[model samples]
Target: MNCKLLSVLCVAASVHAASAFTIDYDIPAGNVIVDSIEGDVAKVRQDLRDTKNGWFYWAFRVKGAAGKTVKFVFTDKYGGGPVGVRGPVVSKDGGKTFAYPLDGKSKADGFTYTFGPDEDETLFYECHPYVLANWEAFVARHAADIAAGKMKVETLCKSRKGADVPRVRYGCLSGTPKYRFLVTCRHHCSESMASWVVEGIADAFMADDDLGKWLRENVELMCVPMMDFDGVQAGDQGKNRAPHDHNRDYTEFLYPETKALTEWVMGYAGGRLDAFLDVHCPWVRGQYNEFVYTPLKDPKVYPATEGFFSATIEKLQEGGLRYKASDDLGFGVSWNKGVTYEQGWSSSSWVVHNVKGLKTCRSFEIPFANANGAVVTPEKCRLFGHGVANALRVLMENSQPKL
Candidate 1:
């Protein structure tokens, strides 16, 4: 073939290949129920038609009065790629249009969004939107306490990019041991709310509090903040990658972060972990309260047991965080849908399988754009953190061996 003809054919093939990987958008049939407002997803489906990374997105419109901002919950269906629900994008006209992407920052392990005036508008994601450097700064700011032995910061493992995924732990105790707890956040790079929550828990543990004091004396705490460091830093969703999600990778011990975390839990807990809570934020719409999923098939998992799901729910309620119950939502769903559907392949399930002593293995799904009755914000996230910390205290309390 002539050189010119060959070049034309190559370009044509390239374009065809690019077109083959476009993002596909879809709208599922569901609605989000927030404590602040009733949110129904305008649509639930793949948001992109073509992308090289096999991207799939779901878009939902929150409907409310002119001045009323409503928050909607949307799931990423299944599959395991970078999944997201963009929000806080105001449409001055009801659903006629969207204003802008709720602005945010991408970091090594997650992103943080700045909710706009549309207090009702919000978005959640599974990709990085902030700078990892910011987290490093946070670590630096608190380095003194960590170095002084008041707090602990250790490198659990390094990522594919060679960045270290650090595990932070801090709590002071006084009484006899009762039960222990393990909390992990940001296994999916874009799930930032949990990152902030984890930080809040850290603050509570280090700061003066009766609960913190009690924890130190009676319970042990293990935490891994931001498990998908490389993906978070790169602004990649970090899910559905060639390898697997940081959460699901636990089964094969693939990713450095997941491997490190699994090893840490097994070794440190020594099969005595009382509970394991994997923190995360769900899509833009599901009436789903901050809920827990209990595998219906687990003989050892009695979701109806007095202290199992019931007990955990009670603690969450007391902490001021509302939640509901859901099915296991297993790995099978993940293969058929998008990232959000990648449920069972998580740290939550691993705890159930490996940690025989664990009483509860649950995942906390906070709404990305909105949670409860309103949109998500830093302040609200802080409150969420407090609730989570309180819940941890309660879980330990309930699990304690009688004096």
Candidate 2:
């Protein structure tokens, strides 16, 4: 071969090799802001705002660097912190499943992961995140249940950006249900684990167990899985967004989701809205943030809410990362102190006021990444969710109608 031709072939091979090291955020639930790259290190930022400044969303994928260490120093600008003690979430199988902390060498700013030669691409995130992709997977699994009156699906609203928000209803809505259950989740996009619990609730309640059978027969349960649909897609914080977020939209109804659900609850038929479960995740970690808790609500439903929690805690004793009754985040503590619905009304507060003859408007604060020492995984949360249904059914069965 001529020297020039040989050189040309070598250069082409080099270009092909380099292409394997690319990184991107173009897939579903992809959220990342790459600031710059130097050597084997990448400086990335979390884009936590749909419209305003925030720091609660982050996700990205990386290629190349196989068998070599790559450093990602993410800026902790607006409290979008690590998952548990680990640094971000890492997904090796194209984001289907994930493991936390990137398993990297920790740094003051970020962490480093030495990718295995077999690792093609791995996704990293602020926490263990569930995106539209996860929802799609769930939908596919339960499509039959949804279609056959075992479960019902409602479109909460078209988002400002045209995404369809889902309101999943199981059991009947008419005929004076003996008990009614309402579940709202993902008011904050960064709190991804909340939706998994919602899944557990619906899955368990629709199963063939006593709770599931009874739920289908006499109870009507509805869940708004992703209230801030656009925010979750855009990787926005969805918590404390300027003007208002979906959760904060409970009163004035600025967001389309807020408006639709506000009206739906107010106009509930037969006035049997017995239980309202607002699932959420607390800030990264701290004294009140580690375990699950229910922020204080109206004193009127305290007994009912307490009863529900006691029942739930009793049923959730299946080992890893479970919920406890002692973790109750009451008034003046956790997030209840001086929290204002000034922007509008928060979800729990709005439900207490809007749902006439409401039984218990309760909130569940799950951890974003870790609960106590146990890492909060989707499966565990789902199990906890199922167990919660057991409790709800027990509570319902034990109560009699008003005289």
Q: Which ten contiguous residues of candidate 2 have the minimum total lDDT?
A: 77-86
lDDT of 2 by residue, 1-403 (tens): 9999999999987876774466678766677778877667878776654547544566788877677677777765444443344567788888777777443345435787788988877777667777787887888888887777687777888988988888877876446676788898888877888888888888876686776777877888878888888877777777778776777777667788877887677675433477788898887666777777677654653335455556555565443665667667666664576456566778877666556545456778888666767777888888878877777776666654222
Q: Weakest 10 consecutive residues, lDDT, candidate 1?
A: 21-30
Taking the tens digit of each residue's C-alpha lDDT, what string does model 1 give over 187-266? 76656666766666666665557866765566656777777776555444444556556777766767787777777777
Angstrom error at residue 40, model 1: 31
Candidate 1: segments with Cα more than 4 A from true spot: 1-131, 140-144, 173-178, 286-299, 302-345, 400-403
* lDDT score for candidate 2 against the true structure: 0.72
